[model samples]
Target: MNLSTLTDQIEQRYHTQAEYPWAKFPDYAVFRHQNNRKWFAILMVVEASKIGLLKEEKISVMNVKAKPDEIGSLRMMKGVYPAYHMNKEHWISLNLTEIEEGLLFELLDESFSLTIKKPPQQRLHKIPL
Candidate 1:
């Protein structure tokens, strides 16, 4: 799927907005949970060679958090690479132009869920008679 379509899916499914945090990289987009402000996914344009491609053409990619064990297997798949600027062990960069729509959404859901913080429990006080 294209960038716009993927972005629409993220906004519609997660009810969150994308933030352009870096002034220098204006095209880069970051999706984060509103409550915690932790990034779930980041979309950026980079040289294809940076992600191991032979050529230096610029390509758009989405970086998402992944479980440690799954990272190895995911790297074996086409279009998935070690995260660009995040922790390589727990995160992965997916070539937006190369992955399937279903897989992309699935990974995005995983990333979104990973960044969510649990709500605090409310405690009730007993009244003295």
Candidate 2:
């Protein structure tokens, strides 16, 4: 899927907006959890060769969180690759146009769920006010 379409899907599914937080990197957009503000997905356009493709033409790509155990096998998929600028072990880059929508959204869902901030533990005892 393309950038607008991807962002639209995320907004519809999670009710979160795509944020552009970098001044120097205008083309990059980040999608984060609503409560914790932890990033779940990133959309970027980079030179194809930068991501190891043979050409230098700019292509749209997205980075999403992936399970450590599944990273290697996921990379073997047609459109998934090592993360462009994230921790390689916990993230992956997807060629936006090359991946199927179902698989793409699956990854997006996993990424969002994986970043949810667990609530803090309750206090067992309370002192007098």
* The best candidate in terms of lDDT: 2
**lDDT tens readout by residue for model 2, 8-121:** 888889889989999999879999988889999999999887668888699899999999999999999988989998899999999986888889889999998889998898
- Deviation of model 1 at 30, angstroms: 0.3
Which stretches of model 2 miss by more than 4 angstroms? 121-129
In the predicted model 1, the residue pairs found to clash are none
> Against the unseen true structure, what C-alpha lDDT does each candidate score?
0.89, 0.89
Model 1 / residue 10 / CA error / Å: 0.9
Q: How many clashes in each candidate?
A: 0, 0
True-vs-predicted CA distance for residue 12, candidate 1, Å: 0.9
Give each model a TM-score: 0.88, 0.89
Error (Å) of candidate 1 at residue 13 is 0.9
lDDT, candidate 1, equals 0.89
